[model samples]
Target: MLLAGEQWAARFEEFQREAWRLETLPQYLMPQESEELQEFRDGTRIDPATVHNEYTDRLRRQATQGRLQGRVHIVTRPLAEYLRFEFAWYYAPHSLAGERIRILDVTDRPNPLDGVQDFWMFDHSEVVLMNYEPDGRQINREVFEGDPAKFIEYQRIAISESVSFEEYVTGFDL
Candidate 1:
């Protein structure tokens, strides 16, 4: 059953709070940027509105495709280097609400190196990343399991194709 109108509002509020609480730590978080975002920043100047449109388009596409099933929770973290400028954006699943229960974000660690207890819900089959890299590329991490090293490799590929910071924040799906 699809949550509509007022019911969705309540559910969304609950999800937001739950998402924030779950994502409050640093270790569970993943890096946002890849070399591609750097290339975009180095190559051109982009406005926040443009970035917003990019994300909106992406999400609209996803919505149309029905990929955004359930109460999908999204958390976007800004990436900065040299503590000077915000370079990239990180997107992760904070929760998934549906009968299948495909994904869930249970922790808020900022960097993945902090050693997190990976929650293998539903037999470790539902971990999917829509935007795995700072470049705005989407991916599902479940396919790359077994080899820990391949996880990072998959991330690298996703980041290489991710969208810009502007797109990530404003244009793309949050």
Candidate 2:
């Protein structure tokens, strides 16, 4: 929703309200420090604050990049856990000492016309193989990478194996 812009992105206050709402749900199970205020009274609050700042920074960078509306998928259990932890402590209520959040320091990428393109290639970090469908849907599969150079070779193979389109314009107006 953040990627689609203001209309789809929930305001901070609204997002907080939703998180609280989620807490009230019967089936919602959260970690110890995130379950309630009691969890933090006995432990340290510094780590959670750092993580919260990092998450906020990530979102801020994405917003600035015009990729704020880009979709994020928690593919692994650890990733999901961290997301929940960040939201529950830093974002939802800052249960640990009311920590302040900040945006991340993200690098800039080239624009669309700059000849560089972002493709749905394989990602080792996420452990998934990305394949595009004719209707624009993406198919992610689990694959192994024994050789580092296999990525370039596989991309070449896929491109050669697929059909492509071309435009035949007969007139031009300068």
Find the 10 residues in a row with the least total lDDT in model 2.
17-26
Give per-model TM-scores: 0.26, 0.21
lDDT of 2 by residue, 1-34 (tens): 0122342233322332111100111112333434
Error of 2 at 51 (Å): 7.8
Provide the clashing-pair count of each candidate structure. 24, 7
Best-fitting candidate, scored by TM-score: 1
Model 2 RMSD in Å is 20.7
lDDT per model vs. reference = 0.30, 0.29
CA RMSD for every model?
Answer: 14.6, 20.7
lDDT of 1 by residue, 43-153 (tens): 543442334444345444444444442221122343223111222222321111111111122235343222322211111222222223333232333322343443344
